[model samples]
Target: MGDVWAAGDAYEDYVGRWSRRVAVPFLRWLDVPAGKRWVDVGCGTGALTSAVLAWKDPAQVIGVDTSEGFLARARAQVSDTRASFRTGDARSLPLPDRRFDAVVSGLALNFVPEPHLAVAEFGRVAAKGGTVAAYVWDYGEGMAMMRYFWDAATALDPAAAELDEDRRFPLCRPEPLHQLWADTGLDEIAVEPIEVATVFADFDDYWRPFLGGQGPAPGYATSLDKEHRHALRDLLSTRLPTAPDGSIALTARAWAVRGVAGRPA
Candidate 1:
């Protein structure tokens, strides 16, 4: 299954809206002072970047992503003069060291091949005492939306288990995340669960995004043959807990981690 983030609008529809809910509390957790320079790594569709610009009042916000399509959409959606978008690797940020007062990423860390290296890079670009933070869905259990999808998918096809984010991204857990921060020499490292309500008006509202094939679950769904795909959909339809009015309400939880960049010894 292709996990590449090539489509902007599809992603925005699928996870970007839910991610914005997490971004607000995640930024509040950081509690950084206003007017500080910031860098948003993997700033997909500018959700986190836009929130930072609107709420934090940063002096400047540089948003970086590997996908040019995402960057283009970010630039178009976020018209603030203080915000700029660039195409760059998160593992090796293009900006100079110790330039930004805060470096943060949202819903993007789990996609990185080497999360520890990416966290180290965040530390490298952050000024001493700057805040470095990131948040990712708890794919193993708490991220109910994808957890339910994967549970249904794996029940039908065992091979699909390998593609599951829970199995694929072990670093998404709090222990590994906290260890990575401590190992990087970051100070006051901490991890917390950020929960948000994912309310869908109807089953179609929930199922339509999966057909977009932008994220892992959607990609896997589209990769299957018509028969198996329909079977999986049928199974999910029966399994999901739908309210009396046919609305589906679920909780999505993400593990948010933060630390302060320490001065070089």
Candidate 2:
């Protein structure tokens, strides 16, 4: 199974904690209303789903992911009686049509083999005039931390170069997102760049998560043999700057997008 959710622990340990924090403000920006039903796609650990529940007293919040292990952890983190988690694929949602008032996804669309189809499903589930918004990590040169690590790691092993940042973070620029929104038949499309700072207590705090082998960078790290692992680690450490207290601070970009579902009349 290609289920990325199987990588739950490493995801939460490394990117999950920071990624959730960064997405909080974007959810607020969308103005999700109270008492509305919500679906959080790729809701690893329920971070974005939890954020939605916190702001809007949503009538219901369903967090969907492909990894049962991730769903288990997400269930534990979110104590809201109104919230629930499910294991499912993004391209095909199990919910009824027009059953939700809004659909919100975060940092997840990039991993889908067909993001456009997933977006259409998100739109399909939303009630007419309902909102659909999403964000993804910018994996190009400006994404910072991942960029730094990948640059260093790939240099050590040319074979580890198939990471799919480009396909996942495709909305980094405005034109592509604008085109995607149009293609999806969504109206009022808006796309913007959001910056988030990832803080680590130390370089070890930053490096430790890569050992989890959950996501792309971690997968690369875990795939290496003993000799290559040490070299990759050393190379990353050299590339990432350390703080006086031995912490690391890296910045990342998220492409935030929003639009209304259905034909743009």
Candidate 3:
């Protein structure tokens, strides 16, 4: 199944909001020093880029994405003069090699058609001793938000299993990520989990984002007919736990990996 990432506002509504929660801690895990140049590959809506600007105090950040719509919104949201948004592919970034102190992507690597090539590109643009890091939702289980939805959808329609992110993105897990870094020749490789709370005001707060059709789950949702969509929604509502205030609280976990960009031998 193809991943949808065309609209910025729709993306922000779907998963970008939660992505922000993971950014600060992801950057903290890297612990890169301030005033260093950074490149945010697949920097959709500027979530990670904004986090670096606010928390890491980077000298400059270039946010790249294939979608011009995402870049436009990122440019609008990030008013900082030090930040710039561009349209570029992850496998072949449009920038000079060995120029950045750090290269990072949030919730993006798995969406790349050839993640290994993208990882190499990240390594290519990073200076020696610079950090290369990325994080992706653990769609197999830890990402409760989509997990619940997919579980319900698959139960209702076994065909939905084909579209599940868990089945589609095996690289999101820790072991595979470690192997990727190792294969890329990056040194000091490490992987960890980052989880955040996602509390929705009500079922609608949780359900409305699915209608945005900007990601895998949403794409699956919008693909269904009205009757099937309603059935899936009803099934999810029954499965999820709601509080006294009719709010739903779930945890979203992402697998994060980092490594030092080694100098060419």
Could you say which candidate leads in TM-score? 3
| Predicted candidate 1 versus true structure: per-residue lDDT over 231-256, tens digit per residue | 99899889888999999999999999
Pairs with steric clashes in candidate 2: 110-168, 202-246, 202-247
Q: What lDDT is reached at residue 158 by model 1? A: 90
What TM value does model 1 have? 0.97
After superposing candidate 3, which stretches have Cα over 4 Å from the reference? 263-265
As a whole number from 0 to 100, the lDDT of residue 180 in candidate 2 is: 75
lDDT of 3 by residue, 75-192 (tens): 9999999999888999999999899999999999998989999999999999999999999999998999899999999899998989998999999999999999999999999999
Q: Whose lDDT is greatest here? A: 3
What is the clash count of model 2?
3
Model 2 local distance difference test score: 0.80
Candidate 3: which pairs clash? none
Clashing pairs in 1: none
What C-alpha lDDT values do all the predictions have? 0.91, 0.80, 0.94
lDDT of 3: 0.94
Ranking by lDDT: 3, 1, 2
Please estimate how well model 1 matches the true structure, expressed as its whole-model Cα lDDT: 0.91
